[model samples]
Target: MNGIDITVSTRLIQGLTNLSLGHVIMILVGGVLIYLAIAKEYEPVLLLPIGIGAILANIPVTGMTEPDGVFGILYNIGIKNELFPLLIFIGVGAMCDFGPLLERPYTVLLGAAAQFGIFGTLMLATLMGFKINDAAAIGIIGSADGPTSIYVAAALAPDLLAPIAVAAYSYMSLVPIIQPPIIKALTTEAERAVPMPYTNNQPVSKWLKIVFPIVVTLVCGLIAPLSAPLIGMLMLGNLLREAGVVPRLSNTAQNELINIVTLFLGLTIGSTMTAGKFLQWETLGILGMGLVAFALDTVAGLSFGKALSILTRGKVNPLIGACGISAFPMSARVISRLGLEANPNNFLIMHAMASNTAGQIGSVMAGGAILALLAR
Candidate 1:
């Protein structure tokens, strides 16, 4: 009976014995993520699962990170071959409404301009002694698009995936907090007050919506064959949304598919944040540089918006340029709110949505461009 008691006690203490300072720190980090999600309402869907995964990963003897374990299996099947991010893109594309973008074609330029941060940060990362591949992956965090960041990092710098993903999603949630001050500092009151015309009178044709995806896929694939998987899947989702006859398919892609994929992807990514990998000077550098990348993207977009406002003789609201980050409705909403705050008559939501959607495509293009240039 005493032997049995001792054996049970030893087994119970095994986890405590193996726990390290690093594990404690990581667990606390996980708790912080959870707090942020629940209390701050910062991307609860994504962060909650991630936080739970991180806590589970730190616990000793769970066997969850083993070769055939859940994390390992998810990592191999979804992340290793770049399947999950691509799947998520399909859902994102389905959720995107390209009508505004089609109506205001010039906003695509804002999206393109926003992508300058990815390259700018890449050069800086290389100068900071990151390998070309790692720098490229790290630079992609500037895309401000989580799936793009994940897709690029998974391909180029799997080791840095956890930090990159966390930075990407965290900053995305903080768009309202991070972008406003920059937008205010960059533009004058007159610029922010500038009102642009929005015409819902001329609805984009159904045919155009359906055709845009196909043409984009064809052109983008040809220009960057390496991006075919990324762009193709995205366009496919958009096509499903636009097809009009496939509501079931589109709804499934938008809701069920995306939700499931996000859960698994976030958790799997969190599981990778083992203390051995996460607690390092390099991890700190990646986090800092990611903020730099995000700021650069916003700055570039605003600068271009200012230029466009100048060239167009105030016909374009420079404030809309801030929407060119790929945080979707959030960035658009931020720009719209800022516009309203500056000038109540200024209704910039549609215009901002145009730029926001353009940013989405631009981010994917930027990722494809990186893959094309460096993944070889």
Candidate 2:
């Protein structure tokens, strides 16, 4: 005590001593996230790291998120600069097989229809008293794409980032549970039993595959210049994968690059979940609107599918429409399962996948549209 000041209430020595009710609640929230990842096996890759980050950030004096700290460095490098989501999109494009969407071009309509959720939720948010930009950020959760939600929120409503990210990723993880009941309630048993066989198993030519990504990038960029960052990165990754000239780069993008970005992104996003920011009326509103957006996406998709089925005189399975919500393989598999349950031999995976992938593209484009409008 002769040479140094010793304060009993200093944060460094007061971890548990300074624990408040808010900190306790945040700790439990972090535990719940970890439990969901481990026990329920829900989005384990992202959730586990985010859960740990949440605990670390909420600790009284860890300084993990201080300006010079690890979390802060990660946030500035990744989330604040808007690099992580684009990086993840590269991986997504690398892993994507667009042949299905190419084969069934009409399914693009389902993808387009599903995007109504984004706009619908935006309007609702405005009515609920959110600022226009914040509403735009919150509504993008309807895209059902975590990266897109993050990208848009980072630009339009950085303050709402934590709740929006949590809501978007959580709903994406629960796609299997949330989609089925809504699908069942929307479709007739007979509609579910209808078969839409996929006879096109032909491989796309290497030249067409190479050209596709380039064409898509140009078209999306021309139509929505604001979307170029997101869409251009996505198509660049796909082009690398399909060009047959950069297998090494494509492989790196899909695996190591994506994985590293994911880890840092999760931790940085979780840092924003400190109790003071997360437990607010706005957070609740975002969570609620996020659910509404998801439901509307599903309903809209199913409605479009039903109409297509009627137009085609039962040759098309209405269930495939429900796959057009950007949930990718999960939504595709759900529709396929429902088809099989209705008729043991009813094979609809290819059909559903066609729409699912298109929905992915549609979501990117929708995010671009929102960005474009907000820019003006």
Candidate 3:
């Protein structure tokens, strides 16, 4: 009886003995993410799964992150091959309405100009002693596009993906909080009050809608060959939406497909946040630098918008320029709200959406350029 009791005690206490402070800390961190998701509603779809994965990853002797474990297999099948982000882009493309951009063609320049933050942060990261590849991955956080950030980081700096992913999504959600101050600080009362009436109500050409995505894919692929996969998938999704012939496929891409992929991607990314990999000084640096990258992108966009306003003699509202990041309709809505606050009659959602859509294409191009130049 005594011998049996000793054996049972040892076996039962094994897990407790193996537990470490790091694991406890990581679990607590996961709890925080979960709390934020549930209480604050910040990216609940991704953050909730990410938080759960983080907790599971830190459990002693689970082997969930082992090479043959579920997370490991998912990571290899979905993330390592870069399949998940591309698929998400298809859904994003399907959901996007390019009519706003087509009607206001010049907003494309705002998107291109917004990419300056990416390059600017790249230089800054390089100067701060990071490798060129890591620097490039870090710079892409400025794009404010989570999937692009993940795609670039996984290819260039797989080790840094955890923090980069967190930063990208967290900051993307905080666009309303982060961008408003910058936009206000950069523009004066008159600039904020500037209103551009939406007088263009002509129907867009159906043929142009069908052909636009094809032309964009071809041109972008020729310009940056590596970006072909990312842009091609995006264009394909948009074509499905615009082609008006594949309602079932388009609906699937927009709804079921994206939701499933997002769940898997979030879980896999979170599982990578193990104590050994995630709890480091470098993680702090990545988070800090990511905020800077976002701020820089906003400043660059707003500056270009102001300049464009000056060149056009105030016909173009500078507020639309701030929507140039890939945060999409959130940024556009922010601009619209601010515009209305400045002047009750100001309606900028249409104009802001034009710039927002352009930013989506711009972010993908920037990611492709990085891959083209840096990928081994």
Candidate 4:
């Protein structure tokens, strides 16, 4: 009887001791993520799943995130193989509406200009002692193009994926707060109040819409084969939307497919945030560099906008230029709101979108360029 009691006690003690310090750290990280999601409302859809995954993975003796466990299986099946990011691209493509950009082809340049953040941040990171490839990966977080950031980071600096992704999404959510001050500071009251004529006459034909995605895929792929997967998937999603006969497919890709994959992707990414790998000096550096990249992108884009405003004889609002950071409709909306505040009649949404979309495509191109330049 005493032997039985001793055996049970020994098993309990071994179980308690088996709880590793790494698990404890992971739990704390999970708690932080939870607080950010719940209290801070930071990308709750993704962060909530991520936080839960972190907690689950860190639970001692759960084995849920180990090589043979459930989360591990999911991670190996998707993230490890780069399946999740590409799949998520399809969803992104389906949901994106290129009408505003297509109507104003000139906006493409704005998108390209906004990409300055990626390259600029890359250089800064390299100067700060990061490896060329890792620096390039970290720099992409400023693009505000989440998938592109993920795709590049996964390929070049998979180890830094968690922090890079968190930073990218977090900053993206904060665009409303971050961009407004910069836009207001850079543009004069007159510049912000400038009224631009609206145009509804630009008609994008179905043929051009169809051709747009195909052309972009070919051009980007030809330029950087490494970006082929990302560009290809994105274009495919766009193609489905433009094809005009695949409403069902487009709906599924945009909603159901995206929702399901987001859950898995978020959790798998969170699993990578194990304490040993994430709690490091380099992670903090990446975060700092990401902010630098975002600030520079806004500055470069606004400078260009200011130049355009001067050249266009005040026909262009410099505030619209700040939308070039690729935060999608959010940046565009912020510009429009500020425009209204400066002049109640000013509607910069459409104009801002041109630059906003341009920032998106430009960000991807820049990502490819960085990959080409550094990954080789």
Report every candidate's CA lDDT: 0.92, 0.88, 0.92, 0.83
> Per-prediction RMSD in angstroms?
1.4, 1.6, 1.5, 2.1
Once fitted onto the true fold, the runs of candidate 3 whose alpha carbons sit more than 4 angstroms away are 1-11
The regions of model 4 sitting more than 4 angstroms off are 1-16, 20-22
Candidate 3 per-residue lDDT over residues 1-376, each given as its tens digit: 9999998998788767878999999999899999989999888888999999999999878788998999999999998999999999999999999898999899998998888878889999999988999889999999899899999999999999989998999888888999999889989878989989878799789888889999999999999998999899999999999999999999999999999999999999999999999999989888988988888888999999999999999999998988899887788999999999999999989999999999999999999999999998
Off by over 4 Å in 1: 1-9
Per-residue lDDT over 186-206 for candidate 4, one digit per residue giving the tens place of the 0 to 100 score: 777888899877767766788
Clashing pairs in 2: none
Q: Give the Cα-based TM-score of candidate 3 against the true structure.
A: 0.97
18 in model 2: Cα distance from truth in Å?
Answer: 3.0
Candidate 2 lDDT by residue in tens digits, 1-376: 7335556446447898878888888878888989998999888778878888888889987888887899988888889889999999999999888887778879878888888889999999999999999999989999999999999999999989988998898899999998999989988888899978767778767788788889889998999988898989999899989988889999999999889988888888888888889988899999999988988899988888889988988788888888888987888999999999999999998888889988888899999999989944
**RMSD (Cα, Å) of candidate 3?**
1.5
Q: For residues 6-77, write the lDDT of model 1, one tens digit per residue.
A: 999999999998999999999999999999999999899889988988999999888898879999999999
Q: How many backbone clashes does candidate 2 have?
A: 0
The pairs that clash in candidate 4 are: 111-358, 111-359
